[model samples]
Target: MEFIDFFILAFSAVFLFLWWRTCFTKTKPKNLPPGPPGWPLVGNLFQVFLQRRHFIFLIPDLRKKYGPMFTMQMGQRTLVIITSPQLIHEALIQKGSAFASRPPDSPIRLVFSVGKCAVNSAEYGPLWRTLRRNFVTELMSPLRIKQCSWIREWAMENHMKRLQIENFEQGCVDVMEICRFTVCSILVCICFGAKLPETWIKDIDGVTKEVMLMTSPQLPDFLPILTPLFCKQMKKAKELRKRQLECLVPLIKNRRAYVEKGENPDSSMVSPVGAAYVDSLFGLEVPGRGHLNEEELVTLCSELFVAGIDTSTSVLQWAFLELVLNQEIQEKLYEEILEIVGKNGLITEDTVEKMSYLNAVVKETLRVHSPAHFTLAHAATEETELGGYKIPTNVNVEFYIEWMTEDPSLWKDPDVFRPERFLDGDGVNVDLTGTKGALKMLPFGAGRRTCPGLALGVLHVNLMLARMVQAFKWVPKPNEIPDPTETFAFTVVMKNPLKAVILPR
Candidate 1:
């Protein structure tokens, strides 16, 4: 009995030693980055849980405590935050290949499925490259975009006409709704072949409008099961997804029909209107990437519309509000447009580039009203080291983009909406949004995934701005103060949504 007991004890000891070695051995991840300490399993998510809008106030505090790059745990996941340009450049631009992958987004899959159309959410692979290339070359290319100039002019013309109608006697206009509709019209024309089927058009527009609210920041992305168990938001998202899907599926079918006919879809394009983004993207297969099916095409279209609508519209509305609030800057931009572009019926792409002050105004608005507050999100594809710490595979990373843009260290007068700061304007460390240096201000985000539509967004903002300002002068509503208060349902939206009267300039 004694001999048997000894043998059994020895066996148990060996087994325990081996199990411990296997479980605790971490090779590549031993030296990632450092961050805030938190309780085991639960993480520092509680610190960010209930903000008026997803931790905006907490961001500055976090930056203070942890510096630009810090560590936090959200539920079972551990994450690293990158706050500076150098670090962001390293991860996104320099080591683009290894760190470019996204976290598992099974949730988005219920709405958007596989293939060439799902560029943003698609796994980092050839298919995504194909779609991106298509967008860059066929859609946003210089020649192709010029072809669609007529579409933009048409959309801008219609938008100005609507503003004329809504300007409360052409003195003040509802900047928020008007902006949303303007962006929606431009995106619609570019994406779904302009004159869409009735059901399709309504479907795309309704969903496009709702996208701003749908992507509202949630801490539960890291702990998704919690969303199913605790959040009512999932239910609402489901209902909205159904509404969007119904509208989009038909447009995909229509385009597929056009592609099936040997005729190039580009034939129907109206210059400066629907241009070749639609004209160029059809039935073409990427070399390594497979062709997109119906569902994929629909998802891509949906992404473009949603992404375009809120961000573009919000910036335009804010630009106008700044103009109304600061009549001086408004006049400055107007004078530049008048001097160079001549208050012409159309503000062409090149014409937009010439007005430097107008460019500053748009940049300033983006600076103060930075969208995608927590931008460097999702996961890493591989294990890597950032700032002397190991980032494990699939670990979620968060960057306080809005906070970084507004960081006093980066901007001289961060709170003040001064477009002049972007001019030959001088300050302590260069003004982040200044035209020459953009590394500091990540209004369009940073890295390989930095907004592909940056150039287009710039033109969109400027064109709409020049057209609206030249066509009508905005006035604050009588006895109603314009509220700069922002509540994030996505894109750091104006809490009250800028309300004003329009005066024809």
Candidate 2:
């Protein structure tokens, strides 16, 4: 088929779906929560489109005026926004079994490569639950984390040593880029049972960042009619994705070659033992789980790399920014570490657990800048009541978590950077991972889909922060103010990356 002809066909298909949805499909949900008046056909699209930042921020403002729950329209989609923890709990935890299923997806199939991810993006079902079970059992078990202590220690030392060197000529290290590279490398090793060299990860981070930094929904994603239109961005994503697939595929093949040749080494380590997660799907066995096809394995790996790279990296960048911007806070934390470890001198998992002040710094950073700003689009599977309004089946819902975390009602001086709030009077309940509830500081997100990599992420942030503070003295340039502006993207980046003079103490 000619490109134009294919385009025409795809447009006709989606146009019909939209037309049918508008004319025949039930449009009204009598029980749905109230929303700002929307224009016909466009719904509330104009309001958000004109001023997305100010408009989304209006949700909590509306809640204060309207109520905790209210409906908002974005084009043809109906979104229910809930701010109250009580309501959020009811939906995500109480009625979770029913609503946990992800809403049907369109863009994910066309633009995203990680199709049908189990833990992060999978629909709530047997497949999703099964994958979660496997992850918890094989990867996230406490014993496994303890075994990976050496991995954490090694990554942290490299991050610190590398930054210490960068502290010389640059005066300021791009801690943000370094953080992303280290985390991506760590997760690759964990999932694939082998480590891609640091340089390999550093190489791919730039491409992946380009792919993520584009905030506009891919043309192929937004306008259903555009798929046949010879899209360049889609083509760009494909070319980049192919390069990534090429890099990852060889590693899988090599592991297979090694295992087949009876060169198997580690059994106790979950990774690269016999059938790594990569090996399972490649072999179509998945060990304890049933057959997961090649597509499934590739999808899982893509999700792993992206998730590990963005979340761990963003948190670390924020932690460093906070430390540099708040020098007194940094020194106090170093003193706390000194008080506990004294001559222990090692920032191990055990030592990090004792550094309560260090934990607070990370938590504070998370509150200020959530990684996935929208928290990975959630949806309702069936009609449900929320905040006294009945929501219809298959409607999309989003919690403006950025709004929720920053709302004046939920936090004291919500804008200020303060680590002391996280400190308990007894100083023992410093839940750095936030396995317990943190009403306002949900950078890793909340509920069932809360980041699966939370343990590793926490270890990365705290260890990196502790070591950086202990090893170096960071000072802002004499006349320049720290640029706190962050690039608004999938994960936030410093709009003007943090630049400061550093002296190895």
Candidate 3:
């Protein structure tokens, strides 16, 4: 068929589908939570697409109109958005099982997820349990994390050297990009069992970034029937995934080879610190599956790499900016660090635990500038009810987590950057897991599906922030005030990247 003829045929089919659905199918789901009425067929599709970049920010306005629990129709998919803490607790905590599974991955996303095999993408079943259990116990346990402190220390040393060089030559440093590279370095060691060269790390980080951008919601994601329209885009996504595998597979093979020979991979680059994530996957057994293949290993490692690096980097960047803009806060944090660790003492994990003020600052940063605006899209395993409203199994349940942190009822001055808030009252002794106490803020989500890497993520932010402050006094560049305006780039980040002046302490 000619290209124009094919286009006309596709358009005709879509129009016919919409016309038939309007005439015969039910427009509104029964007993669904209140929401803005959607037009037939396309059904709020344009509204979501128009504000896709800032939709997380738009949830508050929708909550005002439709109450805490609201629903939106995106083509054939039903999205249930919960904004209130009570409803969030009721669904994810009170009835955790019904909502534990992840929503279905769009076809393109499955290419990266390797058919729902990664920890973050797996369904809540034997497979999910096994993956989560292995990851938490073998890879991210407190003991394992402590054993790998050398990796963080190595990355930290590299980070300081790079920043010192940049600050000396440029007068001001671009902290985000520098920190991203540093975090990538740390994760490469953890994921691959070796500290890769800067060039290799950048290539791996680069391909993962491209894959992440490609995996963001696309038109075919909402309506599978329209996938034909996105053939070119889908083709590009596959190519990116191939590039990602090419960058990572060699490291996986090398790690496996070293393990088979009973040797530590890249002994010169990495210490004999337990096993890397890839090392643990060699003989991993699933319920029906005996062991993971190379693609599955790559997928899981990629998940680990992507999950830890970007969010941690973004959080680190935000924490640094906050410190630079609020010198008093920075000094207070430094004083606490100085008292606990003393002058020139390494800010190890043990010392980090003793710095309550530093912990408060980290918590406050997470609350104020959560890297992700929403939890991974969750779904009902079966027909369910939330907040006295029906939740159909076909719907995707999305919690606007940023609103929870910003809710006035839960916080005093939600706009302020005051770590002191967490020093006392309801904020004190707050459980980040959100399984205990009230669900105030959960940047890593809550209940059964809470991020298994939560402990490691917090440690990364705290250690990096403490060391940065302890080593230097961060100040805004002479004529540059940090812009706190927010933007979404796979994660919530400062719209304007932070540039800071650093002085030796």
Candidate 4:
């Protein structure tokens, strides 16, 4: 009722409005995808960060409220999540060049990737193109794949031996651990051209796992001021890097020495596989980039090592779990394998190709449990329109591969484990490449930046699965069926590691 009281109230209201505008309200120039509103200073940061494990679950609800294409603000960054296959096709395929470049890495990622020299995180330009081309031509080409067949056979045999030991000693084997060890051993052979002792294989595996856990997106990544508070993680990352370098440097040095001495690097391996991946790198001459230095070489090898082991292991783990759950499907696959390669006959790279049911099972596994829920985030090179929404240059975009593949409209009984979908009926002869038109499924991503390791990954999965099935009958342990509950590692992984009984057929 007094003049001073009225004046004080007005002042308070004006101050509150100014604070809200400055901290909470994000200015929009024109058209941006619709999303949930947030509190002052921290927009959707806590909401998304706290529920990252169930982040994919939130998308469907968000899509229902804000359409297929929507935006979310994480601190200062704007993330555009694309759920529809059509929109994904538009951005990643039709307008791929406009969206191919990766965004700048978070501080943690930069440290892990060794200044972003790794192929996956490298920016789109001469450097990226050069590195990618080298990877494809020297390491992942069809000829190279065939040349690496000996490595595959040796690795598969070693895997079987390890599995047999585990099954004998424990009666129930941890499929996830043995699978990871086998893949890591194979990767070490491919990368370094040697059959490392089990201890060294494990040492490398531990380093890779640490890096994956450390480089995973964290709150400090979104809010840099909090990075100091997360000093433990940063220190751990540095230590992992040091351990990684220690594991890899010797191999690189030895290969370099072999090259200098004019000796064949492949001679060091258990089986000669033409040139090892490291040997190829030694000879690679990237245009404008020249020869890769020691640190760069270590970083690239680390990328390949982790990418190869993690993705394949995750897929195979899911494959085995699916087989354990669906015994009939497993029977069908084993029968098909028997028909293709007689019981006593060896299953080689060529033999595995002829087995259609095996291929279908692997395809189905990828469709149902795509290892990566999201591709590494891509940034628009310039202003673009996706799904009729304006996307500004440098806006971070992620294609929802898992969501697209599992869309009810795209495939029947999408939730059910049905390899037969790829074999016959409505889903018959589906193309996984997305090159035919829109991608029905993209476990390895799609477009120019599609995983360079696609061929290698498929070969590894098929061979591992086929051999395991042929060698043993796998079943869930008593009261311990393999649970398919998913968790986020660098890849989508089993929260509960698969435990199964293996019996010699």
TM values, all candidates: 0.83, 0.85, 0.96, 0.92
Q: How much does candidate 1 score in TM-score?
A: 0.83
lDDT of 2 at 223: 37
| Local accuracy of candidate 1 as per-residue lDDT tens digits, 1-505 | 6988976876566446534543575232355466667544355766556444365556667778878887776654666777776676667666666676666653533444442245565556776677677777756688767866777877777777777777646566778777777677677767765554334455666776675456544545655544544346667776776776677665555554554553336444333323435444556685564565555556677777767777888888778778889988878777887898676645789888888788888888888877667663646777777776777776766656666566677678789998888786633234333234445677765565666677787788888888877876677889987888877666777888888887766
RMSD of each: 8.1, 4.4, 1.9, 5.9
The weakest ten consecutive residues by lDDT in model 3 span: 265-274
Q: Cα miss at 337, model 2 (Å)?
A: 1.6
Best by lDDT: 3
lDDT of 2 by residue, 301-410 (tens): 66667667777777777777777788899789878877877634887778888887888787778777667556566776777777677766667776556765676776
Give candidate 4 misplaced runs (Cα > 4 Å): 1-29, 50-53, 262-274, 287-289
Candidate 4, residues 195-273: lDDT per residue as tens digits?
Answer: 7778988988988888888887777766554565578988878887788889889878876766566455545544343
Model 3 error, position 80 (Å): 0.5
lDDT of 2 at 344: 44
Candidate 4, clashing residue pairs?
A: none
lDDT of 1 at 239: 72
lDDT of 3 by residue, 1-505 (tens): 9999999988999879867876788555689887888776777888877775567778778888888888888887889998888888988899999999888899889998889998898988999999999899876777788878889998999999998999999998898889889888888888776877799989988887887889988777777778978899989988888888888888878777676765653563363534687777888897766799888888998898778888998998889888988889999999998999886989998999999999999999898889998999998888898888888877899988888888888888888999998888547877887889899999999989999999888888889898988999999999878999998888888899999989999
**Best candidate according to TM-score:** 3
What local lDDT does model 4 show for residue 483?
77
By TM-score rank, best first, the candidates go 3, 4, 2, 1
